[model samples]
Target chain A: MKRARIRWHILVFLTPAVLVYTAVMMFPLFNTLRLALYTRIDQERVFVGLDNFRTLFFDPIWADQFWNALGNNFWFFVIHMLVQNPIGIALAALLSHPRLRFAVLYRSAIFIPTILSFVIVGFAWKLILSPIWGIAPDMLDWIGLKSLYAPWLGKEEYALTTLALVSVWQFVGIPMMLIYAALITIPDEILEAGEVDGITGLSAFWKIKLPLILPSIGIISILTFVGNFNAFDLIYAAQGALAGPDYSTDILGTFMYRTFFGFQLQLGDPHMGSAIASGMFIVILIGVCIYLFGIQTRMRRYQM
Target chain B: MNKARANPYNTAAMHGALILYTLIALFPVFVIIINSFKDRRSIFREPLALPNSESFSLIGYETVFTQGDFFLYFQNSMIVTVASLFFVLLFGAMAAFALAEYRFKGNLLMGLYLALGIMIPIRIGTVAILDMMVATGLVNTLWALILVYTAQGLPLAIFILSEFMRQVSDDLKNAARIDGLSEYAIFLKLVLPLVRPAMATVAVFNMIPIWNDLWFPLILAPAEETKTLTLGSQVFIGQFVTDWNAVLSALSMAILPVLTLYVIFSRQLIRGITSGAVK
Candidate 1:
């Protein structure tokens, strides 16, 4: 057999991306995980061996904030999964209707928010929902539903949900577009087949189309899961790093931010921040693993 | 299709629902843009109304221009985003070409290693990244933002690009090889052009996030000189929160560029998404 020549060009092609990604992303991530197992004591870095994790999970003060943020993060994810995905799927279905008018205009318009920066979306909603100058109250009044209006972003009970909904408003286009893509790809023959079987219109969708798009939905669900757990910019932009209304809107991202770079009177603790990041990594990993091992394996991906 | 045509009432409801959601999506943005042009008082009084001659004022924009380094912030954002996009596309394409064209040992492992960052966010490593930045003196520089964004963008770019690259006709590349065209030549001259649409998809996907990212800019490069448009608007808006005119104008200013670009590229972007580039 002839000796195979070493493809130096392949290495040359791959080196830049690999080097940059490793140095900037992978190395930092592993270092962060390592940092989580260490702590600074008296200005000296010392290995604490999961003490930070213990503090984050078991210590009363740290545990309270940690759990609150985790719970809020889950709620954020839930809102997205429950409200955003369904609405997105519905809008996509509506848009995909063969006779739907102005479908292009509607999709483009609805997707406008998705392209805007979170700073823009966050502050835009903050103003629109402001108690004083906000038009939410006025709009409600015009509709004779003034009693339904409140400073939703200011009230503790409503803050996180309001932010989550705002986030949904910005990102619903994602699922919609993804699902829409999946919908349009469904062969006409299949729908015609469904119609022949008396599964037309809404019934057709519920029975035939929905099953085929379950894989797309699964992908969207996992994307939403990852996005929601890592969400920070909206809350930070709207409510500041405090994630206020007494931290009702805080999530793992903000919690990590605050701990990594202390806010107000609290001193920054990198160790605890890494610990939080690790916790988030675990949560996200668990979610992804469940999807991969538990859910994805069971879903049937239709070839068509 | 016939069922949809037969149900006129259903069609009406579908249009109605779509129109309603469309309004809901565009309303806040519309209000902000209009209000930004009006005097602060009109902004409060007729927040929903269009700007009339009597209500029109440029003071908000004037305030925004004078109070912050809006131009500098814009320049910084442009530099970072464009530079990051350039590196991401180039490096990502090169890497994708290798994986697609060359059958090598550990290729699967290499693919998986590169793809790891797709599901796991780059933000989790901010602690050590910041530390490394500080150590290397890249903190508070555009370089820091660019490097971070390049890393952030590469995984998805490589993944998408490789998928497209695989579909490029092997016959063309083999013929080119027979012609004594170097591998690099084939990649640069042939493969890159073939994958332009996917490159656009990757670019569009990464562009918005990089331009709009507030976290890394806030943490890694929060200095006055290195402030991105997103961070600048954020800090500017935070300070001028009580000033509705300035805030609205600042926001509108922040929004106008992105909105304009989006309008221009909206078709391409939507097409990119629905084209299954991501799937």
Candidate 2:
């Protein structure tokens, strides 16, 4: 009887969170997946199991857009992995130096962009790179690299990559901070041991600190993967829902938003929108699973 | 430590790289803010120049204030963000406390269930979420955004708070229990105060995303009265794109509040993140 009374309090504590999370998050997510498996016909819901999936994959019109978006999404992820993570790691490594002057100032300033809304970053970059505004051209001329100036955000070949770089600029702070945190936790004794063994300076970083921080790197990688795939606001704010320069910048998020919400001439299609979202879900799940099972489990966490 | 003394060149190079990156990060924001104070022609003629008495103008800010429902949007954003933060911290702490303090059946399962949102982006359910909101007549309401944000924030809140709750000394809680304090009182008086730093960390983490979120606000609360600062700024800038002064000022207005808050709380925010509350 006493134990039963005790258990009641547990339910009391858990109820509100469980109720809210389920109603708003889990239920809607599962419902979306369910919606994807069905389609509307004659203003009534109709079961169309895997037909949406088949149309998305095999049908030429849908297939082209889906593949384009998916490919662009992968490139977006690749840029973050290759560009953002390395720069972030490098910045963290530099900032973590014990005698570095103005380390806090540098860290704080670099992270300033991260806290601003995507709207600000997107529009700010847009204005800076605007051909009419002449900032980019002027800056290039100042540096005597005027020949390199182009309206990158307006060019089909360069729009996606340019936006990806902008995103990297805003977000590199995350990995930098995370890695810096990890780097600071390393026992000074370990580095001293490496120093005593004639492994100091860059060599000490490479041979000792680098290996110790691999787990942090892995965490940063997965975060980049998840964040990149789900990214919408930057592209939407900068490129519009059409994700143009001829849809070159259309990642899954923008693609799904356009498909669901409708834009210009296109009418909304919730079923197909859910299908795209479901596709994103699978992609993110695969990436996360690979990290969790394939990478995280294998990486040996040091006791220190 | 001696590496600094031994390698002056290396130290200089590190500082050089960091300084260059910091400048790059701040350049655009600085440009926007400065030009917002300048007249339109001068903004284009000398975008990099600081606003002097000759260039200074408040025309753009006047336009933003008069033309758009900017204050309403700010209020809506504040309401949604603050209300959501309250529920997320309260309910999340309660749930986290239950998991940390009790060894109940399905505890791990419940914890994992709550944690699913941490890895899975909640935006996947936009289609259904929109439909449900419409069904419940919540579309275009601040409550819709608040509820969605609360759900979105809870998983991470529980995850971080649970870690902190586990570190709260058990003896204190037991002694409180012996004094005839109920579980709720023990939670309110004992555990919650101990986990305040973690709560602040969770608040800092959730606050930015909620404040700056465009997706939910755009989708659920796009009505004129219900728009958030982010969506409002986006729409305002879109309409006034060619009006350079107004555009720059609108962008500046949006940036200033978040910038000020970030500057003030940056120490606590950095400490929270570096304290490994996330990992």
Candidate 3:
């Protein structure tokens, strides 16, 4: 009877949040996914089953832009995975070093960017990279690499990669923090045990610390995957809604924004925007599911 | 001492890497900040130099104050951020209490439902959300930003708070129940105070992103009257790209408050993260 009463209390307590969140977040996400299935014709919304998906896939106009944005989004995720996680891991390893002085200062300095508005970072980088201002060129000249300087944010080739690197700079602190926490969790006795076995410094980290933190690394990888795919603000701030010079920096988030809202000569198409959002949702879901089921289970077994 | 000093190789490498990465992390801000105190010509002539009598000028500050309404934008951002944080915390805590303390049929399902917001991007529903906002005539208002941000923040707030609350000892609530404390009384008197740490963590998590975001401000509230510091600075810098001093100062203006707050709370923020509050 007492257990039953507690369950009742739990239900009453959980209802409001769950209800509101479901109505607002999950419902809309899935609704967007459902809305993607149907197409609108002459102002009437119709259930065309997979026609929108087909159009997103096979239609000439969208197929080009859609695949381009999708490919950019994938590359964007790849850059984060390749750059952010490794830097985060390296920082975390350095931070976890017992001999380091002012570890707190280093951690905070590294994390300062993550705390600022992306608008600030994006715009600041844009200003710093502006050719007219010549800060980048001047800085490069000081290092005797003046020829290497270009307005990377303005260039068609370098814009997306530049933005991705900026994002990595901002968010790498997260994985660092997570991995640091995981490092702190391992028993001191294990490290002592390793030392006793003549594995004192670098080998101690490589053998003991790295294995213990694999789970945290896996978690950070998935978080980066989801975040990079949904990213919009920095690109929007740096490149605007056109995501140009000729849509060079277009990622899924900006693509969805441009499609849904319409800019310049393009008409706003809610159905198509929903279609793109649904595509992002599907991609994110696939990444998340794979991480949770595949990587996590394997990591857990390794952890034990 | 002899052994340790003999093996300077690894220690030197470790310190070398840390110093290099720290410089990489800090140099951009350092360069901008130090140069902001210099004259326009001095800014470019010796961008790397610390400002002395030869480099110092207040022209940027003069231009920023005379040519811009920075204070107004800062005020707007503060209002939107604080208001959103307030709603997200109060209602989020309330809903978290409901989930943690109750046992309805769909209780587990409901908790999962709330937590799902963390996984999905709220930007997916931009079309409907904007349509609804306009239909209600909230476009260009700070209230529109608040409502949208609150909706965006509440899910993760509830999820984190609920996890913290469940760890609150069952004995506390059971004792309150036996003593005839009402559910609301138990929550207000017993629960709210205990969860202050969690509340702080949630506030910190939501505050930075909401303050920094450009998408919502750009889409829903782009008017001069409603511009946040971020949108304001982006425009300011874009227009004044040639004015190095003004651009750097404008960037400084955006960085100062958050940098101040971050330095003060970084220890607690680190504690909050390593404590698994965010997870």
Candidate 4:
């Protein structure tokens, strides 16, 4: 009886969180994959096996959008990897320097945008870049570069890239903070030894600090990958679910949303939407699996 | 250390790079807040300049309040965020305690299962979540949002709280046990207090995402009564796209509360991250 009573405490403590998470999170995730395998016929869900998958892949209508969104998503991830991570690393390196004046102030300032809602960041950037307002143009004109100013958000050629950069601007602080934490964790004795060996400044960063923080960087990269692929709020906020200017910025998240919820002309298709979501799940799963099996193992070995 | 102080040229260059990056970081926010306070003409005419008495006006704010139910939206946001944070912290702490303090069956499996949500976003489950909400008649209700967000926040909260909970002193717990305190009492009185800072850190980490989330609010509960500040602002700005005054004002309204919270809690937030709590 006492053993049973003691066990009840664990159950009492664990039940609420586990129940809620399973009901709302895990069950739904699996259910979505199940839903993807079935399609509606005369308002009833009928198991269609891989029919939906075939339609999604071979049907030009769906294939074009799927591939386009997938490609755009890749580009978005690439931009963050290339631009945001490097910039974040540089800022973190600089800020982590011992005796840097006003480090806290700079960190707070740089991180402010990260805390702002996607709605605010999106609209603020949209307005600033609007050609009619001439704010971006005027700022450019000050440096005699007004000719370079264009309605980047309104053009198919530049909309996705433009939005990607905006997202990078907002979220660079995360990598900076994470990498900063990693940098500070390095022992002072090791750095002192490096200094004794004449490794300081830029070379010191490349030779010593960079290698030690590789695990953190790997984590950040996976985070960036998951975040970019899962991204929708920024695009939806900035350009609507259509991800407009000819749907140049539509990624998997937006595509899934539009498919599930339906936009102006499109009817909501739960089955197909689930398929796209499952597609996204697979893509993310592949990325994560690769990281887990490939990158994480190698990184652990190097760290050891 | 000597290398840093010995070179004035290097110091100047470092300062210059930092200042340049800082400007790039802050310029947009500065432009938005400053322009939100200016009259329509000056907002466009002098977007770069700070408002003087000649150009300053509350017309934009007046329009925002009159046209939108911003106060109600703020209240909704407050309720949802606070309620979600409470549940996340409480439930997360309990679960963390169970995992960290006990040698239980399926503990590792459960931990892995919960941590999966951290990597695989809850957004992917929207189709079924919405379907379930609709089936249960929870769609278009704030409860839908609150529930989903609680679920969304639990994984990270559990992970971080458990890490902190593991560090709690076994000696103190044993002493409490010997003093005839119940396990529940020990957790509430001792372990809970010990992990308070971590709980604060978890709350801070989760707060911004919950408060600033546009997707779930848009998907789950976009009804007027259920609209959060982020969604309300998004919808309002979308409608008033051409109305620069209203648009800018609405955007500022969204920014101010979050910025205020961030400024207030930034020390805890920064310390929480830099203290290796997350790592």
lDDT of 3 by residue, A102-198 (tens): 7887888888888877777787777678786677898788899998887898889999999999888888889999998888777777777777787
TM-score of each: 0.98, 0.99, 0.92, 0.98
lDDT of 1 by residue, B157-183 (tens): 999999999999999999998999999
Chain A TM-score compared with the true chain A, each model in order: 0.97, 0.98, 0.94, 0.97
**DockQ for candidate 3, C-alpha atoms:** 0.53
What TM-score does model 4 score on chain A?
0.97
Instruction: Report how far residue B42 has shifted in candidate 2, in Å.
Output: 0.7
Model 4 chain B — which ten-residue stretch has the worst lDDT? B1-10
Summarize candidate 1's per-residue lDDT along A1-304 as a digit string, tens digits: 5755987899999999999999999999999999999999999999989899999999999999999999999999999999999999999999998856789999999999999999999999999999888689988998999999989999999999999999999999999999999999999999888777877878888999999999999999999999999999999999999999999999999999999999999999999999999999999999999999999999998899
Regions more than 4 Å wrong, model 4: A300-304, B3-5
Measured on C-alpha atoms, candidate 3 has an lDDT of 0.82
The pairs that clash in candidate 2 are: none
lDDT measured at residue B187 in model 1 versus the true structure, 0 to 100? 94
A-chain TM-score, model 2: 0.98
How accurately is candidate 2 docked according to DockQ? Answer: 0.89
Worst 10 residues of 1 chain A by lDDT: A1-10
- Higher-scoring candidate on TM-score, 1 or 3: 1
Model 4, residue A75: displacement in angstroms? 0.3
